[model samples]
Target: MSGRSAAARVDEADYIVVGAGSAGAALAARLTEDPDVTVLLLEAGAPDTALELHVPAAFSKLFRGPFDWNYDTVPQPALEDRTVYWPRGKTLGGSSSLNAMMWVRGFAADYDEWADAAGPAWSWEALVPYFRRVERTEDPADPTQGAAGAQPIEHQRDPRPQTAAFLDAAREAGHRVTAANLPAGQGFSRTMVSQHRGSRSSTADAYLRPANGRPNLRVVTGALVRRVTFEAGPDDPAVPRATGVYLEIDGITRHARARREVILCGGAVNTPQLLLLSGIGPAEHLGERGIRIVAHSPEVGEGLRDHLVAGLAPAARGGTLYAAEKPAELANYLLRRRGMLTSNVAEAYGFVRTAVADRIGMAADLPDIEIIFASAPYVGEGLVPLPAEGLTVGAILLRPRSRGTIRLASTDPRDKPLIDPGYLSDADGIDAETLRAGLAACEELIDTDAMRTVTTGGWIQPAGGEHMTPVERAELAMRRYSHTLYHPVGTARMGTDSSSVVDPALRVRGVSGLRVADASVMPNLIRGHTNAPAIVIGEVAADLLRGRSSSR
Candidate 1:
C-alpha cells in the first residue's frame, strides 16, 4: 500500500517501467542492483495477497476474479462467433501468477527464427545465458537447463496419478516419452513448474521480493499508466523523447518523471493499447481517437498470435483434482504442503509434429501441436467448475498461421481493446486443418489402454463420444471447445525491418528513450509456453540497459 497514502506529487526515477508484472518486476529489480540507479515499477493491480494465488491447483479460481484483467475477444467468425474469454493477470506477478506454471522453453529454431527477424543477439545461443540468468532449475536433467538463476524452476512436487497415466497413454499411443522443453523434438514429460516447495513462485516472489529493501527501487501498486508523456527530442523537435508516464493511482492523476528512459513491460495486450492511447501507433488510428500523433508506427498492434488449445475431458473413476479442495486434501495441503492442491492443473505436456505441418514442409524441429494433460475437467475455459471428476487432454495449435489485431475500442484507458485473434481464418483453411490433426492426437491419447484405465467411458466435454465422425468431432472441438492457452505475442513485434514496432535492441522506432521489454516485442510466438521466455526478456532487457555485452 505504498502508493495508497504516499505524498508523491511528482515521483522521479532514473528508469520508469510500466506494468510491474513478469518483465517489469525483474527489470526493476535487476536495474536497482546498482546502488546509484533508481527505478519506479508501476502495477495497476494490488499486491499478490490472495490466499488462492499461493495454491497451484486453484489458479482457475482467479479467472475473471479481481486479480484478472478479464478480457474477451471480439466475436470470431470462424469460431461460430464465440466471444472467447482472455483472462490476463492484473496483480503483482501478472499472468505468470494466474498461469498453469508450465516451464516450456520451446526449441532452438524458434529463437533462431527471432534472430532471422532481428539479429544474432536473439538467437537461441545468445538467449541461453539470459535463460540461465533468470531460471534456477531445481532438477536440471539436461545441461541446458539453468541451475543458478533468479526464479525457481522445479518439477511438480505432487502431480496426480492420472497425470502419470496420461504420460503412459502417450507411450501406448505410439509417441516417444521424452523430457519436455527440449531444444529440438520435445516429447512427453511431467511439466516443470515455476514453484518453490508447494507455492507459486512468480516474478513478484522471485525478483521483487528479494529486491524489496532496495532504497533506490520504488514499486507502486494500483498504478494505472494512462499514457507516455513525451518532450521534444534532445536532437530534433520533430522526434519525441519519452520523458515519463502519466499514471492514475486511486483516482489521483500523477506524473512520474523518468530521468533516463521509459520501458514498457505491459505484455502483449496492454503494451500496444498504451502505445495507441499515447498516439504512438498508426497515424490514422490515432486521428480517429482524436489523439495527437507522436509516432506513426502502423504495426504497433498487428501480428497478433497465440496458442489455441481445445480440450477433451472424459469422466474419471477417482483420485483427480476434483477432490483437491475436499477437507482432508485441504488439511494435507495446509500442513504437509503435499497434496492435489500443489498440482499445477496441467501436470504433463509434450510437443508433436502433426501431419498437417509436415504437408506444408514446416521445419522438423518446429512442432505444430502441443499436448497438455490436466487432472481436472478444464472445461468452460476454467471459468465454470464441473461437478464430476474428469481428466483433460488438451490439444494446442503451436504455430498458428492466422494473424490478428489489437485495436482501440475507445479513447478511455479503462476501456478494453478489441482483441481479434482471427483464429482459423487463414485463406487455405490450414489453421483449421492443423487443429483437426491435433484433435485426432487428443483422441488417440484418450483411446489408449492406459487412459482407458483411469477414465470411465463417459464424456464430460462434448456430450457425444465416439459416435461422431472424425470430421464432425474436430469441427465440434474447434467451434465449441477451443480457447486460448493464455499465450499472446507479437502485438509490438521487434525486428530489423523498419515496419516493425521496435528494432533489434528493443528500442521503439520513431521514438527515443523508450523501449519494450515483454512478449509484445516477439516477432513470432514460440512453440512453447511464454512464461520462461518472458522472464528471460526482462533479464535481457536489464543487460541491455546495463550495457552488459553478450558473447553470442
Candidate 2:
C-alpha cells in the first residue's frame, strides 16, 4: 500500500523532488538539512522494506517482481533480435536497493573526459571531493575513497571461494591486482560493496532513513508523478517555470507546489520519459502523441548507453554459492552474518585494455572491457536459480559507441517508456570487437591454474556443451546470452553546448526552476559501475541547488 494518506493532502513545499530513487532520495535528504526548507520526495513504488532488498545475494530474486519496473527493450537486430530484460528498482532506494552494490568509481581520466564535454567542474579532480562526500567506506586504503559520508561501502565479508580464485586467475594471467576505485582505475580486485554489517545499504538506508525524523521532510511512497506543472516565466514568457508536479496518490490526483524548484531524479529511463510526458521533448515527437509542446528540446530521450555483458557459466565443483539458500546456510547468515549470503554474486572485477582501436588511438589507456566473476549460474537472465553448480564469467563492453533512446509509449503515465539500447549496433563494429576481446580474456582466465582448481571443465550456459570452438563461442555469446549490467546513462546528457538536454550545472536548458539529477544527466558513460556515480550526482545537485540565488 501507499504511505500515509493524510500527507497526500499536504501539497506545497519549498522543493519538490520526483522519484525517491538513488538521486532523489539523497537530494531530498540533503535539501532538508537546512530545516527551513520543506522538501517533498515522491516515489512511484512501495517502501524499501522488502526482505529480498536487504539481502546481498537475493538481488536477482527481485527481478521481474512487483518491486521492479521490469522493463524490456525492443528487439535488437544486432543481438539475434532478442528483447533484453531491463530491471529497474521501483522502491525507495530505487536501483541501488536492487543492484549488486559494487562501488566502482571509474578512472580519473574518464572524468577528465567529462571535463571535455561539460566543464572542468565535472573533471575527476573536481568531482573527487563530491565522491568523497557521498561514501563512508569502512576501511578505505586508497586516498580517493571517502572515509566519512552517508553511503556505507566495504569489502565483502564472506565471498565465495571461486571469487578468490577468479582474482587469483586475474593475477596469474598477468593482470594487475590492486585496490578498488583508484584514480588510476586499472587492475583487478575484490569488489567493494555498498553494505553495512553484511546487509545491503542503499541510498534509502544511507540517506533517507537517517533524515526521516526531520520535521520538514515528507517522503511519499506509491506516488505516481504524472507530469510537471508549469507556468509562464517572469522574465521570459516563452520559457516555462516548473511550478510543481501533478501526481496521483492512492486514487485521487493532487498538486504539490514547489516554491523554489522541481528536480527530476527518475533516472535515465524515467527522467526522460517524465520530461517527454510533460511536453518538454522534441516538437515532432510530442506532436505524434498529441501532447502540447512546452519546449522543443530534441535531445531529451536520445543518447542512451548501457553496459552490455555476455555471461559464460561453466560447470563447477562443490564450494560455490549453489547451496546458499539451504537452511543451515540461512541460519549461519542470520545468526552470525557470515556465509555465502553476504556475497554480491559478481564478487570480483577487473579491467582490460583491449586491442580494438588501441593502436588507432581511439580511447587509448581507457578500459574498453570489464571482467566480472559471479559464483553462480546467472542463467535465464536471473529469472531462475542456478539449476546446477556453476560459476559465471561475464565479459562486459566498457565503452559502447552504440547509443539508443528512451521514448514515450503512450500518454498515460502508467505505461512504461520505450527503451532501445541498440546493443552492439555501433557503425564501426568496435563495440562488437571489444566484447570479443573480453570473451578471449574470460577464456584465458578460465584456463588459468587458479580457475582450474574449482571448475569441472564444461559449459553450463549458452545452452550448449563445451564442444564449440572459441570463435564460435564468442560469436554465440555476442549474438545471444548477453544482458545488461544495469548501468544505463546519458539520456539527458549534461554538457556546455546548447544542444545538450541539461547545462553543466544540470539545469534543463530551455526551462526555468527545473533540473535533472540522475544517471540521465551523465554527459557520457564511465568506465565502471553506475551506482556510486549516481549518488555522487545527487550530492553535487544538492550543492548546486543550494547555491542558486534566483530562478532561471
Candidate 3:
C-alpha cells in the first residue's frame, strides 16, 4: 500500500471508518471479518511500520514528528500560565503508536459510574466480557483472567532496576503493591503493558496490519476528511441526513458514500470538531461563525476531561539507568530485542487514595490518585537525562472533577480546534487539601528505607527546600509541575439527553447513518489511562453495527 494515487470519487462501501487509530483499527478489523461488509478506512497520516514505532522507549522520538498531529492547548490558568503541548497520533496506528504502552483497566467503579452516567450497559459488570474478550492477559485461566481472545497483554520481561526499587519503596511507605489491572479489591501494583514479546503492540500491529490483505477492506492514507455530506430535501430547512464524507487527498477532493454507517474515530478533539464543522453543534455558536446550524446539540463539544500528572525526579545509583547513546546497550537491543529498547520507561505504577476517604465518597471501593513510576523521565518538557544516575516518579490525579471544553477554531476542517482542558478548574477548584495529601504520599514513598538507599535531598519546587511548609509546597507544586497524563476524553459525550451529540447506542443524535466510536463518546473520563478502553469502544461499536447486542 505505497505511493497509491488518489482515486477521485472512490467506490462506495458498507462502512466508512475515519482515522485509522486505536478505535478505527479495531472497528475495521472486526467489521471486515464479515466479507460481505465492505469497509473503507480513511487516515490523514501515512503508514508507520517503522522500527522507531515498534521500540517502546523510542516513543519520545515519534512525538511532534510526521506521525504526530502536534497540537498545543490554550494557556491553562491553573498551571502558572503554562501552555501544555498535546501530541496526538496522526499515523496509521494513531496515538497508540506514540503512547506509553501501559494496559490499565482503570478501576471497576469507574465503569459503574459510566453505567450510572451514560447508561446501564456501560457498567463494569456489563462491560467485563468485552474487556476480557479483547484482552489476552498474561496470566489467564486464573478465573481472575487469561489471555485468549483479542490482543496480547504481558508484563515487562526485564524491568529496569529502578522500577523494582520504586515498588519496594511503595511497600516501605506502607502502601500495598499489587497488580495494576486486576479486579477492584486486588489492591495496587505494577503496570501490565500492552506488549507482545519485546515489541510494542500498537493497534495497527495487532489488528490493522493483519487485515491489510482482506479484499473487503480498503485503507486510504493521506485523506483528510473535510465534512460529512448530507442528503437533503429541497424545501427542508432542517439539517440533511449524512450519507457520505467529503475529503481531500493530494489536492483532489472526493466523496465516499456509506451504505451502513460513517464512523468517526478521529479521537476526542477531532471528533467534536468534525461534528461542529458538519453543522451539528450549538445553534448560536454555529450561526455566529457564519455556519449553518443543524441539530443544535448544545453539548456537542462540551464536557472535556483529561488526567493531569506532576513529575518527581529522585537520585539513582550509577549503572542503573539505560543510556540509549551507549554503543553496548544499543547493539544489545538491536541484535537481541533486549536491553533499553524494550523498556516502556513507565513500567511500574500503583493506585491509591490520596485522602483517607474516596473523593466521590459514595463508595468505599474506589482509589483517588494513581502514581506512575518511570525508569527514566520522559516528560512533556522533553527527556531530562538524570544526573549520571537518577529515577523519576509521576503522580497523576485520575478522575479529576475539573471539566473543560473543545470548540471549533473555524469552519475549516484543516484548522485545529481550540482545546481548553481547563485543568483543576473544579467547582471547588484547586483543592489544596487533596494536593497536600498527595504530596504527603509522595514524601512518604521517598522517605522509605528502600528509597533512602539511593536518596539525595527531595526535589520539590518553590526552590525554598523540601522542608517548606505544606501550604508553600502545595502552592509550588500547583504552579511549577503539572502536565498531561496523555489521556483525554469526554468531548463528544454519549447520553439519552437531547443535548448529547450521540445516544447510548453510539449513534449521532438527529443524524442518519453516522456514529462516533472513540474516546470522545465517553460520557465521563475513566479512572485510568484510556488506551485500552478506547480500543474496547471500537470493538463494541463494531459488534453493534453488525447487529450484535452490546451486551456481547
Residue pair clashes in candidate 1: none
Candidates 1 and 3, the one with greater lDDT: 1
**Global CA lDDT computed for model 3:** 0.77
Compared with the true structure, what per-residue lDDT tens digits does model 3 show for residues 1-552?
Answer: 331227523668989998988899999999999999999899898877678888887887777788888888899887888988888998888998888898887877888777877788788877777887778888752353536756788878667876777789988777787765766754556778778888888888888878878988888888999988787623453545678899889877888898877999999988999889988888888998887766778888888888877666655554454475588877877888788778787888887776534544735766667777777644334434334455566567766778888888888888989989988877775443455566667666766788777656654233444667645655565557667878889888888777788888898887677899999998877768899889989988988899886454
- State every prediction's TM-score relative to the real structure: 0.98, 0.97, 0.94
Residue 66: error of model 1 in Å? Answer: 1.1
Task: Give the range of the ten consecutive residues with the poorest summed lDDT in model 1.
Answer: 1-10
Query: Clashing residue pairs in candidate 2, if any?
Result: none
Question: How high is the CA lDDT of each candidate model?
Answer: 0.88, 0.89, 0.77
Task: Report the lDDT tens digits of candidate 2 across residue range 1-552.
Answer: 124433555588989999888888899998999989999888988888778898898999999998899999999999999999999999999999899999888889888988899998888888888888887997787887889889999989998888889999998999999988888847998999999989999999999989988889888888899999999999999899999999997777888899999999999999999999999989999999999999889999999999999978889998888899999888888898779898888898999987785854765567788999999988888988789999989899988999999999999999989999999998988899889999999999998999999998888876565888777888888788898999999999999999999998899988899999999999888989998888888988998988842122
How well is each residue in 270-381 modelled by candidate 1, as lDDT tens digits? 9999999988999988899899999999998999999889888888999999988889988988898889999998999977888888899997656899998888888888
lDDT of 3 at 115: 84
- Considering lDDT, where higher is better, how would the candidates rank from best to worst? 2, 1, 3
